[model samples]
Target: MHSGLPNGEHALIVHQAGDLSNSCANVGPIMAPDKKFNVSAIFGNIKVDGTKNATIDREIDWPKDISLIGRSLVIHKLSVMEWSLRNKDILPLACGTIGFASP
Candidate 1:
């Protein structure tokens, strides 16, 4: 993790001076009713901590018969999804808000 960033959030690699962007997460089942996951017939929570100290907190609410885990998700500081495409020079992830939020 970055030397200046808070500990125990994202999976960051610590270097001699600080941290870089080679981080990840388990994206596993969590404790809460986050209705955003679309799975968990009962509401569940999926809290994503990203670079720049940005966080995506939501609830997963689905019908009792249906369950959906995050097959696909994006870690971005973007206010909108299309922001990724707007950048032709910078990689979407790089230009995403995470850069500013990350240490």
Candidate 2:
């Protein structure tokens, strides 16, 4: 069981050309999924949506534009979720996610 991004899925390189980073730097609105632009650098907000909650790393700096609408969201898993819940902060909610109170 190999984990991590599978083949054909390239990591987003903020410093290079690819997608999801250019428009963010032009001081314009970016709705596309891929491109090179410092999104948070200009826009200031990012939003995502999805049916199942996903696991996300806390070290990543989210795009900041304030116009996040209609996109898939990722949430942390059990062990990670517990760490978040134990701390003082609202856990991020993904699309179509169902959460139960801890026992």
Candidate 3:
């Protein structure tokens, strides 16, 4: 998790924005029906002090369809599914585009 984020049930979503290119800014759900990225990957659930800072140690089962590279990670206020359906354009608390790591 980043150093700046409110403490709550934040979801980690991988959006398939464009044609799987560098301009994929859509930020939609990686799955269908319920736009849930991962319920268990809930951020801010860690125990922290007044500063509300804690590291998130989680192992996610990466889906084949959703590639980490060139994709975007969005953190929403509410549940991923709820926010996607209710709002015209979802507002993410924090977001970042995934890139390849140097070997």
Q: Which candidate's TM-score is highest? A: 3
Off by over 4 Å in 1: 1-51, 81-103
lDDT of 2 at 53: 27
Candidate that beats the other on lDDT, 2 or 3, i.e. the better one: 3
Pairs clashing within candidate 3: 18-24
In model 1, how large is the Cα lDDT of residue 87?
Answer: 46
Distance from true location, Cα of 43 in model 2, Å:
18
Compute each candidate's TM-score over C-alphas: 0.24, 0.20, 0.56
Give the per-residue lDDT digits (tens) of candidate 2, residues 28-85.
Answer: 2213534554542121112122422223222445555432333322221223334334
User: What's model 2's overall lDDT?
Assistant: 0.28
Q: For model 2, what is the alpha-carbon lDDT of residue 46?
A: 26
What is candidate 1's TM-score against the reference?
Answer: 0.24
What is the clash count for each candidate, in the order shown? 14, 22, 1
Kindly report which residue stretches of model 3 are placed more than 4 angstroms away from their true locations once superposed. 18-50, 54-58, 63-66, 80-85
